[model samples]
Target: MITWMQRHKKWLVITIWISTIAFVGAGFVGWGSYDYGKSSGAVAVVGDRKISVEEYQREYSSLYGQYARAYGNQFNQEMAKKIGLPEAAVNLAIQKNLILSYADDLGLTVTDEDIAKELVKMPAFIKDGKFDKELYIRVLTQNGTTAVAYEKSLKRDLLLQKVESLFDINPSSNEVNNLSKLLFAQDDLSIQILDPKSIKIDYDDTILRDYWNINKIKYMSTNSYELAISKLPFVTVSPTEDELKEHYSKFKTDYKKEDGKIKSFEEAKDDMIKVLSIKATKKDALKKYLALKKDEMKFDATTVIFEDKLPFSAENINEIKTATVGDVLKPFEGTDGFSIVKLIKKIDPKPLAFAMAKDMVKADYLDIKRSEKINNIAKEAMKDFKGEHLGFVSRTSIDKIKGLNPNEAYGFLNKLFMSKEKEGRIDLGEKVVLYKINSSKLGTDTTTQEKSVKDILLRLQKEELMTSLIKNLENRYEVTSSLDNKE
Candidate 1:
């Protein structure tokens, strides 16, 4: 069910991408002097198309909101800015306009009936297995879009599809057969999974200290917050069954299996309760924050340093840092629950002395030495194996190797397929695999081969065509941007 929904969502996104053109009318809105070429009120202009600021905001907001919801507590303005969401929004706006201009030049048109039919077909606008106009309006309004705007956008999407379809390229059956033979060909190999546990390494105190001195900054203490935190633990809350069910209904996307089916309530009840409880804690924490803001309540202050080492995230620590001494910060949610912090002090990160960081440095040194020892073992084994004649192993036949763990075997096969030298070693955590492919034999799976090649060819041709079209459109159109100017 989840996969079905995901596939549908992907199709919906693709449809939306195909239809609309973004026009940027980046001229001033009557700001300063000198009349900087009439404020067209567009963020950008491509040929005759003008992309308005409102359209850019709508697109950016839609994308931003989706990510914000997906990320939940982790999504913040800082993170959005760091990811260059604003710049991406502007760029996407420009790209949209470029394509729309090209589509217009090609004389592509999407009629009212086309948009109406598409709207009725959308599951989102449907109720009782039928198109509901009121429901459609309500859904669009709820999502900060109007029916007119959505339809107009949908029209552009249809036009894009029309334009893209003209360049469809189909590969011949023989070409597909040849490619399939190459891709599906199996290789035989001699394999061994090296055990890291079997190989031991010894490091003296002097060696550890020397390594620590060189990499001391990597071992520096986290920038922590010394604070009085009142944590509202979610485990204290007991949610009603109705509340759990409601929560499940609202956030069902989170509980979907890879195969797309949603877990039954009975299977998901415990997890649902946990999520609801955390939300409840956050709500309570907000109430506490408000009360503290108004001086109506005072939380018990037990001072502790909040750091990454103490199970709290860097995001939580950063939130704590945002507060000043005696300022009760607005509560923020963490992995455990919600925390309200009164910042007492900010602890700057400090490099630990050799004596202070001995155990940690020793552990680090040992890990490095162990990896080196294992790599050396694999290398030495490779030399010995190269001289001895070993039987070939098929790409799909790694499971036949005696005593190889399923995960290790798959990891070995992945390396085997990807290796450029036809022989290489793969470090699979606890084990290492040294494989050498001796020969390849193509399997007789014509149907599968044909389908794979067809899919690959179609995707490649579309990408190449679209790229060329976009580049040609950009050169053909007289494009200008108002996004670079101020006021």
Candidate 2:
């Protein structure tokens, strides 16, 4: 079922024309930011259509805001760059423009009546189960979009949907039947596993030094920081039962047992008290931070490593990284209490000398040597099995193999199913398995096979049609992007 969903998801994305505002607004944080020229609001020109800065900004903000809320301080500029959010934003805009451009070339146009009908049917634009013009206008205004612009966007989306729906790649009954047999077929296998750790490798100072010289960058020093930190302990504030109960009432749903039953106030009293105490301490911590900023309060400073030695979190470390020396960050909750942290010093990352990184280099060298040795062992094992020295076991699911870890079992099973060779030795880091298939048979359950195949065939059709349509349309239309020069 999980595999079926994974296969069908792309088809669903291609076919469904969801609510425009909601689709654009949701997960916009996944795209970073794009800059259209200040002189013109357009970011990119596709054929005759222009993608506006307003549209880009709106979608980017929505997507980034969602990530920020979910990730807290973890979603920094560096993280955004690593995820290619900016490029993703531009691609999304380009895809939209491509569809719209194709629609325009085909002379597709939506009437005001068509837009009106769609708008009225949308629950977001309706009040009292009926169309409400005032409500619609107000909602659009609140989202920083005008009714005219939104309507225009919606019309384009509908036209694009109409164009996309024209292609069909649905399979025949015979095709489904053949596909079903392939999908439901199960292979019976005989197997033996070899442990990599059983083999040993010897290492000396010379070997370690040589390894360090080649991979010195891997042994680089992380950024370090000097910080002046003061704590506002949450236990200092005593939260009364009444206050705790009030806080509990506001967030009662969160206090749930393993059985899904809501934990009573009595069951959650201790936790509530601690949380309320922390909430009160946050105010005092802020006051302390303000005084620290003004140099009215003194804090004991300590040198801390920015990466592995962090007393707070990666998110807080990133925040500190952005701050200049002498800048004080506001109070944040840590393991013990609310903390006010001031940036006292910053250290840039640098590679360690070979002498200093010898131990780590030795460990890495051993890991590489062991992996190589294991691969060689597996190859030899395969040769021996082919020579018939090793006896084969009966048929069993790859997952049901004795003594293999769950992760290794699933991974090996997936690999075995994907492999073309009937007999081979698979290397799985910790252990290697030698496998040989005796027979393969399709599933006997007709109803399950038919239903699964039908669904898979439909998904394949949708995917094939979508891919062909995109390629044909892209070539058919003139496409251009100013993504390289977003500013």
Candidate 3:
């Protein structure tokens, strides 16, 4: 990509060429870094309860750990920012307190047995398929907690779970069947992926320049940046044997031996040590990031021009492009550690000269021409479109569309079902898919009507209802956040 960009540097309104931020890294090597602060004394007050410093740290860690698990090595600070994970944690903290406050209003309470049942079911507390109280206390003690404190935290978690369950009433059979019909109804489809290569255009310098002039706004120079960076190198923190065992006990299901049974602590020790190292690095990275943000530390500067690709992810590049000069972004992961980045300069996009823009203009011209041609063909098309034979597909036939991706197929199916027309053309940027519905029938395939699909739809139905319930709950309570410590 750099070779291609360098070859066409004259016409480059900087093409988007780099990655977005993710876990802590400086030279772009690690999963990512987080930007949460240390829990100072007391934090936010919601209803009768205060979001204690410990609770604040725990919530942030829980959310961060979940993202790290889900994305694995690909997870980074940029992805976290994109997902608004930190904000989600704050909002979740607020929501939990709101629910607790409302639960109080409704006389909802959690008993000691409820806490016991939940704790006993935890894998960390179970031994030989039974709840072992001695093992439970041991794990807690090793992790620096007593049973009393653990039980108190468990009680709050259980109460939140119980309260949320009340909002998820079971969906009716009729509701499930309606969704099943949408997903299972079979349709005979004919598809044609219109290719840009098929549309030919004889071009001259004059013609190309004219096209560029007509669509000047469409062509621009690449947006670039100059930045100051502070890298927090990954420090290998060797966790104690007890720490590894505690981690294994807490999340034993994550480690699997060859036979698929949970790995013994000894077998999982090395991997668990690496996990602990990554976590320790994240906290250190956050501290480094805060120091940089407060101007307590600084780093030498570097240029991130259009041609300097692969140094940052595409997501982080876009973030830099969108940000103004003087903005300090949270630390993104490096090859060895986390980087606290400050944008020193932003070179805004400018129009590309005709010499530089000729190739791009020609490409865009061909694509637009192809789309127009295909659309016209689609208007006259009443029968078959010669491409791939997609036999029969349901509205949920995500995997069946041969020429398009699952997301493309989903969008097309939704459009196909929504339209009253027998045929239509859908543009998918590089190509166009002209689809014709030859025949249709009510949902009949028992094979497609999977129980799992129904359950997913049922969950979807409940979530739709729950979204509104959450909004109503938010209005019922006044949530004050001290998470950011802003007056």
Candidate 4:
């Protein structure tokens, strides 16, 4: 039931930015570019560990890449600057080195054997069912990294893992039971579902006018674009057996069948060939794009479009919208083939007038009035208590409520259990749950896996331990950061 390693939950302030690492090679970018000098290159120092400019750049890039993937074309260098990604990156670097410093003090070390084992398991490095040194070299070289620097980074990561494992506690049977009982406690209850529709609204025109006046900017016309579009004809090319095999070796994980088994070379060959073709054809696409950029090649078509009705995918459209007028976006994936786009014009959004946004304002106003009425009605009902009796329900009683869906039932139950008050109302979006607890008792469900409960308890313990340990480590480690130093 414990599906993942506890050591994987490494976070100082719950790191939302995790590197989308495909290959160890991807992780090693920029280690080859910088000099690990005595002073100039270092951004921050955590005891003996100097966070170099190259290291800071890699961390910053990793964080940036995550945001780019999440927000698509909305993320840019300017946005990154505004979000203070550099500071976040430095903080993350400091936390990592802080943990590493503690690990060193505790005499923890990641051996050559440890790093070798990790490398063999990675899908990128493995070729022909083993760690291929030549393939590793090629991948690393392609990614602009060297083995020495990469291994050092690996060593640090492994060392962190080793340090994390020290706090991995196995909860005792009694401990698991105690925690499970606390988490899944049942409650005797009187329930009242407060649907907003039950409360009749006056639906005044004055309320609409007030709401429209206050929130007029909420209703705005979307930013439109006038774009010059050109589609690059789909390039289909046959891949050599060697090229297919090489691609397969690099990305074999994606070639898995429905049964979770890796497909054979013969079985996955076509898809592998297509992927390689896409990679190869992009080079030609880029060449064509260059000529197109300089206006040597003319556009095939043009369109003036709103954001909602984009020609390309939202991700691709995002790229187009962000570019300045006359700036060309390189070949992005399209329905037919790769397409290059130039932003000829950009139209800024304007606030919609009251006449245009009246319907929207009315709907919003009605909802606001309905919520106010629901709260007042729920408060009175809680005092009088003329609601239906829904006997004992635990957090696990996800199917106990008839009107509420599984998620709503679980949320209401969880809220009720966490509450110290006997009578309360929980606002669940469109509906409100008003409940009065008659009695409470610990749940006795042995059908669920006790190992899962143990895992949960242990995870919580580890989280608390890590939080405390890291706080103590702030005093234990002497950290100095000059992240302001030129990168």
Clashing pairs in 2: 28-63, 29-63, 29-64, 32-85
Residue-level lDDT for 445 in candidate 2 = 48
Which 10 consecutive positions of candidate 1 have the poorest summed lDDT?
A: 24-33
> Model 2 Cα displacement at 191 (Å)?
2.7
Full-model lDDT for every candidate: 0.66, 0.68, 0.65, 0.74
TM per candidate: 0.63, 0.62, 0.64, 0.62
lDDT of 1: 0.66
Q: Candidate 2: list runs displaced more than 4 Å.
A: 1-32, 37-40, 58-78, 194-355, 386-407, 429-431, 449-453
lDDT of 2 by residue, 36-87 (tens): 5572567777778888776666445554554556566666555554455566
Error of 3 at 429 (Å): 4.1
What residue pairs are clashing in model 4? none
Who wins the lDDT comparison?
A: 4
Reference-based lDDT, residue 36, model 4 = 38
The lDDT of model 4 is 0.74
Which number leads on TM-score? 3
Off by more than 4 A, model 4: 1-97, 109-181, 197-215, 238-269, 272-297, 312-322, 353-366, 441-455, 474-487
